[model samples]
Target chain A: GAGVSQSPRYKVAKRGQDVALRCDPISGHVSLFWYQQALGQGPEFLTYFQNEAQLDKSGLPSDRFFAERPEGSVSTLKIQRTQQEDSAVYLCASSPDRVVPISGNTIYFGEGSWLTVV
Target chain B: SQQGEEDPQALSIQEGENATMNCSYKTSINNLQWYRQNSGRGLVHLILIRSNEREKHSGRLRVTLDTSKKSSSLLITASRAADTASYFCATYFSGSARQLTFGSGTQLTVLP
Candidate 1:
């Protein structure tokens, strides 16, 4: 793909319903990340993956929030029992594989999946 | 609180004026990045400055980093009304390699 791609640009789910957002990272990129951005706020980290292995998920707000990058190319963020507070844009970003942060690979982001729990 | 915090929650400027936004981080960072977002749109990467680099310029955008002060600034020269958007600073924590912590961001409005 030309850039990070996300599905269901907008979603409306009833409270307590489950919703799934998909992301396809840029081709050949080795690092992928997911974030949640509430209105009027910056995007917050949700999880990170180095290849297919999930290295960090401490930022996931609760047990209901889960993300996985199955092939290290495509990822999915699933929210179970969505709440009103969960209404926000779920962002998917990817970066080239770099062993260290100082190496500084640019992180590209998707247009994001806007989820609104009514 | 997030690792990074941006100053001036909101900024209003006329077109052709220069706009500068600041970011402060609490901990050492490997690199700092700036992004722009328009209403209801995804973020667009502006620039990234490494800890070792004091400054970097790309087109009309200039970025400065001060590791000692744990701060960075983004200066947009000759701003345009199309430049109206929210600006954010994200940091790669020295201890964390993959996670990018973002600040609250500054909403910049450039009036024509």
Candidate 2:
């Protein structure tokens, strides 16, 4: 794909149900990131992946949230025992190389996966 | 936790007028970026300002960064109806983790 792609653009899950969102970054993009945006708020950092390495997961809200990028290209964010508070738009972004914006390093975003946990 | 916070949660102006948004951060950053989102969809990259550079321009967008004050401002000259959207400021730390920490954002409405 020419840009980042996300799966299940909209998802509605039961309170206790589990859900998984997928993201396919641009070809050869070395950095991938996941963020959660609530209604009328900004996108909060969830996790980051440099290649296949899960370098940072500190921003993830809780242990129920898990992310993985096994092949260094496609990534998945899984939420177990979903809660209403988890309802938000999950955004996935990718950068061609390291995030040194001074040298024109820009991150491209996907349409995002909107999850509604009832 | 969020690193940046934008001011003036919402703004409305005529199409020909200019729009200005401000952002402030708490800690040091490697770089700051601006993004635009429409109708709750994907976000588009607008501009970037590094910690060392004070100002940068791209087309009609001008960005200024002040490391000492930990603040940045975005100025849109001659706004258009198409420019109505939510603008966000994101900061990338100067460490190993390369992800961005975003602010609440400003909603700008350009009336035609």
Candidate 3:
């Protein structure tokens, strides 16, 4: 894909149900990120992957949230026992490289997956 | 936790007027970036300002960063109705790879 792609643009799940969101980053991109945005708020950081390594998961919010990028390209964010608070738009982004002095690392974002926990 | 916070939760202005949004952060950052979101969809990257650079301009957008104050401001000149969107400021720490911590954001409405 020319840009980051996310699946199931919108999902409605009942409370306690599990859900999975998928993201396919730009081809050959080295960095991928996941963010959650609530209504009228900015996207909050969830996790980051450098290729296949899960480097940071500090912002996952809780143990119910899990993310993996096994092959260093496609990534999935899984939420177990979803709660009402889990309702938000899940955004996926990818950057070509890490931050360096001369080159700016600009991330391209996907349209996002809107999850509604009923 | 959120690293940046934007001011003027909402702003309304006529087309052609300049729109200015401010963002403040708590800690040191390697770089700061601005992003725009239309409706509730994806975010588009606007510009980036490094810690050493004080100001940068791209097209009609101007970004200023003050490391001492731990803040940055985005100025969109000659705004148009198409520019109506929510603007966010995100920060990346020095050692962090490319991960960004974003602020709440400011909703800007351009009246035609």
The residue-by-residue lDDT of candidate 3 on A1-118, one tens digit each, is 6889999899999999999999999999998989999998889889988899998898899999999999999999999999999999999999888535234678899999999999
Residues A4-24, candidate 2, lDDT per residue (tens digit)? 999999999999999999999
Model 2 residue A14 distance off true place after TM-score fit, in angstroms: 0.7
**TM-scores of all candidate predictions against the true structure:** 0.95, 0.95, 0.95
Error of 3 at A18 (Å): 0.7
Clashing pairs in 1: none
DockQ of 1: 0.71
Candidate 2: stretches off by over 4 Å? A100-104
Q: Model 2 over residues B19-107: C-alpha lDDT tens digits? A: 99999999888889999999868999998888889999999999999999999999999999999999999887665356687899999
TM-score of each candidate's B chain against the true B chain: 0.97, 0.96, 0.95
Model 3: residues >4 Å from true position, as ranges? A99-104, B94-98
TM-score of chain A, predicted model 3, versus the true chain A, to 2 decimals: 0.95
